[model samples]
Target: MTGPGRGTTADTPVVVAARRTPIGTAGGALRAVTVDALAAPVLAALAGTLGGPVDDVLLGNVFGPGGNPARVAALAAGLGDDVPGMTVDRQCASGLAAILTAAAGIRAGDGAGYLAGGAESPSTTPTRTWADGTVYTRAPFAPTGDPDPDMGPAADDVAVRAGLSRRRLDAFAARSHARAVDAQRSGRFDDELVPVGAVLTDERPRDRFTPERLARFRPAFTPGGVHTAANSCGVNDGAAAVALVPEWRRRELGVPGLALVSAATRGCPPADLGLGAVPALAALRDRPRSPDAVEFTEAFAGQALACLDAAGIDGHRVSPDGGAIALGHPWGASGAVLVVRLFHRLVVQGRGETGIAALSSGGGLGVATSWRVVR
Candidate 1:
């Protein structure tokens, strides 16, 4: 990857605005909200802030009624008929992938402005069945003969391989919840939230999970695994979007934002999908100068700890305002959620000058993006 701050200022891609709907657990508060419905308000909020026509709208989504949920959301948001939309589905990395795709376009000088992020309403995802009427929960992540364990089992394997103990994983999970609860109590999330319907705050993140309490739960994925339901992220519904433009446009608007430094996506063994983020972050070559802020999607306590350890990142330096483990992981939207969090910390709050957002995805894929605060 190119060194940070290597590109011409005029050609750099900048994120001007970011927003997200309150995350609700699957079949909970957001159960009635469809994928398009969840995204429309977020898109509208971003468009309203930018006060201009969007050249394109890109959204990441896992499941919906199909036929391009991004297009449906754009139309629903009242973006002009001329505006086009694209949907990305890289599993958990979809949101970040969509944003990076838009950034690539801006760097290529293809468009003046774009709206990109991810949205998901797992509660309303349509059930699928084969022609013979056999039901399937999800699609295959690897070809036959390749190891493609479910995320829970894969996370367990990751912890076992990394020699991470259950106590350590439980502590991490409890910390995530505690931090999120504190942030919520302090109104740290108020600025970035876009209320959908009557939901004003995240529906997860209770202060009840101490490490001692979490230890009471039995193994969830394997017979003697370190993973447990309490330590893993919950399936949820939410949407997050960001307004992107070239540095020239941002300069004209005089809006503070995040300037894209570098982004990378890498592949790893399907069986060890949780470690996917390690190589992706390594590819950025941002060593020697650590990012002042880092946000990694915490899909599971064990998986997150394992990845951070392997990547040589200090676990305590990640997600100071908590993470997916506490906020809830709306599969398709989690990666984008990480970016949204970074925007809040680095640009909105002036907490840091440089930040990194990274996440592991199904199918052995990982996505990472580095950003610098632009005032």
Candidate 2:
């Protein structure tokens, strides 16, 4: 698929505006909200700002209502039927995939503007009864007969293989919470968060974090395993959206944007999927320069540490405003949420010029997308 070069130019696809709903813990503030309901508000906020009508809408979702979520969000947002919509599901990487798809459309000369992102409502996820009168929840994380191990156990496997100690994982989790709380106190998240009702901020960041508190939890997946609930992401609900337009349109609209540079997706074995981000970053190693900032989703502290270590990325350069470990992981929405964070930091706050967002997904998928502030 076509994509932008590293340099900013009139032909490049630029992200004009990005916003997200406050991430809510499962069964928390957003439990009653539907995926479309959560997404429509963010979409409407972007539509209110774009100078021209949107050409299309693409959204990523996992475990949402079966109908076309993008179309539902568009209609609910009052965008006309002329705005075609599509929904994609690449599990946790779905959000970044949707963004990449929109960028590809601009490169292919298919359209001038698009709305894209991802949303999830884990609290509202459906439960199903199997053919043999057994109840099942969640689709298989891997292909049938392909050894579909759950992510927590897979994370434990990654820790064991990488020699990540339990103490190290606990330390990472504590740091994530502390950073998130600091960012919150400093108003770092004020600009990008579009309120969902009275819920004004992320629900998962712990204000009084202590390593001892993390150590009190038992292993969630295995006997004497490193992965505890404290070090893993919580099921969450939220939505995020971005307005993408050609660089020329951005200029005409008199709006600032982040220029799309490159993106790649790779896969690994499902049982060791947390390391998926390692190969994704390797593909982008030859870029014009190292990314000034990186957002690697914190699926589990051990796996995140392993991926960052393998990539040789220092902890200081990753997730400055905290990550999924503190903010909660809303599956489909987490990837796009990373982009929103990058835009806020690089473009809005002038923290850096270039940034990368990377995520590891269930079923052994990894996705990475790079962006540069429009000059």
Candidate 3:
């Protein structure tokens, strides 16, 4: 991997705008919102901030309709038929992967503007049927001949390996709710959020959550496991999108933006997949120095704790405005949600000049990307 400073150039990807729909738990307010409907408004909102036409539109999705959501969203967003679009599905990493993929194109001098993000509607997730009319809930996340442990159990294994205790996990989950509540009360999320009907705020954060209360829930994965439903991410539906442009275009537009510094993805054993981000970030030879903050997708309290420990980063440095545990993890959109959070912290709030967003996917894969705020 090219060391830190690898892509700091005129042609690097620059983020001009970022926005997201209010996150809703599965079967909640957003359940009625279709995948394309969820994404189209976000795409339009992003384009409204751009000075000119967007060259391409890319969306990441997991359990929505099979048709090209990006194309559908682009057209529904009124971007016209001339704009090309595509959808990406890398499980939980789809959103961030889509952004990084676009960044690669920008670095290659592909186009002046690109809109990339992720959208998911687990509430509306479809059931599959075979020719014999038997319905199936899911496809295997791992290749044949590989052990495909359930994600919660895999996270339990990671917690055991990382020596995280139940108390710590509960504490982490509690903190997430507290931080999210504080961010909400402070209105820190207003600018980044595009109102979705009557639900202007995320629907998952519990103002009454407490570690003591969290300790009462039984383990959801395995007997004697450290994880509980209270600490793991809830099934959610949401969408997030970002506008990317080359550094030259950003300057010409006179907009403050974040520079896409570096990005990488790594793989590990399927059973230990939640630890993927650790190796992925460790493999990065050139991460920005003295990162002011980090945002890792909160798939589970145990896995997030383990990754934070392995990366030698303080757990406090992550998700100051709350995380998936408190906010909701719309799988396909969680990765881009991390980037959107980073943009708010690094660019909007000016808390730091540089930040990194990372996540581990279901199929034994980890993805990480770094950005530097450039005004």
lDDT against the true structure, per candidate, is 0.89, 0.87, 0.88
**Residue pairs with backbone atoms closer than 3 Å in model 1 (clashes):** none
Off by over 4 Å in 2: 1-6, 285-289
85 in model 2: Cα distance from truth in Å? 1.1
- TM-score per prediction, in order, is 0.97, 0.95, 0.96
Ranking by lDDT: 1, 3, 2
* Root-mean-square deviation (CA) per prediction: 2.5, 2.7, 2.9
lDDT of candidate 1? 0.89
Q: Which tens-of-lDDT digit does each residue in 319-353 have in candidate 2?
A: 88899999988888898999999989998889988
Give the residue spans of candidate 3 off by over 4 A. 1-7, 130-134
Candidate 1 residue lDDT tens string, 81-142 = 99999999999999999999999898898897899999999898888898899997888999
TM-score of 2: 0.95
Comparing 1 and 2 on lDDT, the stronger one: 1
Candidate 2 residue pairs in backbone clash: none
